[model samples]
Target: MGQVHVVGPNRALLISGSGASGKQPRVIVGGRAFVPWIFQRADFLSLELRTIIIESKKSATAYGVMVSVTGVCQVKISGFRESNSGSGSPKLEKDVHAILLAGQHFIGAKKEEIEHSVASTMEGHQRSILGTLTVEELYKDRSAFSARVRELANEDLRLMGMELVSYTIATISDEEGYLDALGISQTESVKKVAQIGESVNRNEGRQRNAEEELKAQLKINEAKKKIEQSNRDVEVMQAKLKEEVNVANARADAAKLFEEAKLKQSIVEEETKQDVVRATVQVDVESEKVRRRRMELDASVRAQAEAELFKKLKEAEGIREFASAEAHRIKLIGEAEAEALRKKELVEVDMLRLKADAYKEYGQAALATRMIETMPEVARAIAAPLAKTEKIVFLGASGGSSSGPSALLSEVTKGAHIVNEGLQAITGVSLGEILKGDSSLNGLERLAMPIALNAVVANQGH
Candidate 1:
């Protein structure tokens, strides 16, 4: 069904669908909607077209509505050419290439549109989408051009409403070396260029290797020198460090010793202080004892001195009294002796007068004497003498005395002086001259003999 060409505003695309897209809408091409006459020429359209059919739609949900849809159909020109004859030129091939390329792009776009419509309707939201073509034939070989293919896939994936979340160029090996080597084939153009570059780079690499060898040798020499210098420096530094270590060790030892010595010194000082304290305590105790003892001794000495002083004072007083008594007795004796001498001389006059009288009587009466007249006046006078008694006196006053001459004469008669005096008279001797006796005698003794002799003679004569 060939249609006549006409200039018109109602331009259209009369493209027929493939697979499940048989009912798909015809989109405008170059802003025209052209009616397709494929139904009248169904045999011609079916003969010339490659077709794929997908029967099932995807599952979708919207606002609690679950809509199950079918998958889209895909179409491509697996083979198309206006000329494959040797005489055919490149123009016809180019047109066929363009038509095939356009048809593939349309198939990819529609597939993505259907998938995005399902995704958007199911999600109940509008989202950015894209469509991309996935041509497995393009990935028949692995080469640097794969990078461009990956970029194209990623770019158009969103535009085509395709999700290229993950991408890998799984090379297909069904064509030539692609089939033999799993589609990892070398591109002929790239291989030829790489071979030429490899040859040219070989020469350049040789030149670079020569230069690098020279540089490496120089660096090796420099490294060797640096290593030798570093060894020398390490040796020097080691020697210096060894010296410092020795110094540090010596200093540490010295510090330790000094600290030890100081500790010992402190200990010694502490001990010395303890000893001093003990010594001081002992000295204080001993001093206290000595002081107490000395105090006791001093007290004792004082007591003894006081007692001796009292004793000596009493003895001195007694000696004084004894000496005074001796002096008084001596004075009394001297005074008595003096008084007796005076008394004896006075009494001796009486004795001589009486003796004179007796001698006169003896001498006269032996011849012729009157009896009455024989008593001489001298006897009478002598016998009557000493009628006043002898008295002891104290310092100008009369003191105590016993019986005077009469009692004294009685006492004298009991003494031996009478016989001695009589013997001295009869023997014609002085008594003092005869016996050399003390001439001092009691006055009573001296006077009594004469009167007794006179009385006795008178009795005999009668």
Candidate 2:
């Protein structure tokens, strides 16, 4: 289908072509001819050589037979040639008859001449004439030998089939002095046309059968493709399902972990609550101990207060008793002092009587001097019983007892004395004054009588 340019005529027969290639070549060499162009390919040799050239009967009748009278034959065929058309082609059958009819005479020709003559002659395949030959004759006669070679070449052409074996000459020889050559064209060759038509019918029938087989194969392939696609879809769906299942499992695991964490948290909270309760209980115990201790301390304080009150009461009672005893002692001392005064008053009354009597007697000249002196001391004693009175006595001589022995009485009561010292200091003055008042000079009223008593008491004081 890809065209190429031809160079010249007859160039393919020149045997100078290069090797096959993908591009079609038009061969030319030595200024001779052009060869056919064909696209070169690796499988080009496998393409059917279907174009077989079969010449018409007109060409055979116009050319003449391919043999002579001595049984010589020639067959002419072209192995390869140029693709181009030309004029004035060679006359083939007349040339082979001329040489073979002079057969024994031609044997004397040189081997090179003989070989050249055979090479130059023609196509080599025939059947009916060449099969009947002697080996010695075939060797000795160029015509017989050529005929035998044609017969063997016939078998080679027959095996390829009717299409490939395009031309045949059954008997071309110089024995008939002329040969019969017939050509049947594909158009007018009834026997050949019938065979070609029969072949076309058989091939068409085979083609129809092959087409049915191809359709069946196509349906099978399409079904297999559908089946493969379904399998792929199933695999994809299965993979997606597996992924979903795994995700669900992971979620379940997470939920379980969450539950476990919650459980642990609850346990911890419960433990903390228990610890708090225990601490509260301990605090309550301590509080109870403090309360009991405070109650005991209050009771002890009350007992101590009671003891101190009792001690103070006893001390107050003892002080009252001591004060009462002191008061009683003072009252007794006053009573005794009153009694001594009363007794002293009675003694003074008696001394005054005695003094009056002595004075009377002395007035009548019947008493001694010693009686007056003793009489004064007795009066002082009487005054001591009543110590509040300040007395100076001027008693007349008749104020004493009427009859008394005062002289003897002075000697007998010489031990009687006044207790007061202040009264003794006035005794001398009293005696002097008494003598002066009593001057009736019958008896000696001495002025110095207090002096004699002074001498005696003064000596006693020493």
Candidate 3:
């Protein structure tokens, strides 16, 4: 019959059914089941095996100190499948049979006997090994002790179909407080060494800081010297610049004198040429004078005609200028009248448009409310100038209708009324109509009062 079995990653399969050929099967399976028969973990497993050596029976070290040792070991079925030589075929001995199970499970009566036997065998060897070594040797070189135990126990474990993978000495302790006392002395020595090292490091750090400061001071001194050298260099450069400027100025003056002298020479040469030209024209001038006198008599008559004609031309020119000026003046007057009429029409059109817009936006009452809104600000503005009045003398307060700050208030009201009249004259907004709160603007002032009060408070906060 075909059977499937599951095996773990740490396990190997061994099957022995009817007509089995070998004692331990060569087949090993891992991962998923594939017609598996028997399986068990073949990899290493650890056992925490410890033993106590009584104080009277404690294993003595080389120095005569007795210590109890606790150890653990890792054991596994050996990788070597066969025990005999190549010529002989291997069979499962009684010990191997006791270690391995028929059903492939590791836990059974025979398995326990084999494990106990291996553990006791290891403990016996551990005690024998500790008896040869001291506590000092055990602590300093625990690997050698564990290695020796494993070496000795491996042979016995092999007979049981098991092998020692590793052995570890978990702890070692003495009956007396010898280890604690030894640790205290070593700790004191370490503390003294650490203190000495710390002191040496601190002194070195201070010396390094002093050296750094000295280096910084040297650099500062070098920088100061460089600054002084740069200043000296700058002074030399300035002196050189000044000398070069003086030389350039001298050359400029010399070039100017040379230019002036050359100009004077050229002027003298031009004057000489003019004198020669004048002499040449003098002879022709005498002849021209004689001929001109004879023609003068005829020219006098022509000149009289030309003067009369010129006077007539001048009279006609004056008349033409006067006529053109009158025409220009008339045209300017006509243009001025047209411009005035156009401006008047435009103003009426704008006023009508504004009124229509206002009615559309806020009903017919907006004009009155708009005027009323301006009155509060205008009143404030008129009172603004009075803010400069540190003192006011009320001459008629004793005999007049109002007195004290109330009289001052009355004066302010009069100022506001006067300003309102001026605004009415300029912008044609009637303060009287605004104050009457006519039309839909009747309760607007009450609503605006809170807005104005909030504004004043916010400004004051700022």
Give the number of the best model, judged by TM-score.
Answer: 3
lDDT of 3 by residue, 344-407 (tens): 5543344445447645775524555445434435544544555555554645545557764335
For model 1, where is the 10-residue window of minimal lDDT?
Answer: 125-134
lDDT of 3: 0.54
Residues 17-75, candidate 2, lDDT per residue (tens digit)? 34433223322222333333452311111111222221112112112432321223332
TM-score of each: 0.20, 0.22, 0.36
Report, for all candidates in order, the number of backbone clashes: 23, 17, 2
Question: What's the lDDT for residue 370 in model 3?
Answer: 46
Q: What is the C-alpha RMSD of each candidate to the true structure, in Å?
A: 40.7, 47.0, 41.9
Residue 270 of model 3, lDDT score: 52
- By lDDT rank, best first, the candidates go 3, 1, 2
Error of 2 at 410 (Å): 99
Q: Give residue 391's error in model 3 in angstroms.
A: 99
Q: What order do candidates take by TM-score, descending?
A: 3, 2, 1
lDDT of 2 at 393: 34
lDDT of 1 by residue, 86-158 (tens): 7666322322233333443444345455444433332221111111112232333233323443354443433
> Which residues of candidate 1, in runs, are more than 4 Å off?
1-217, 236-244, 259-263, 270-274, 297-462
lDDT of 2 at 335: 59
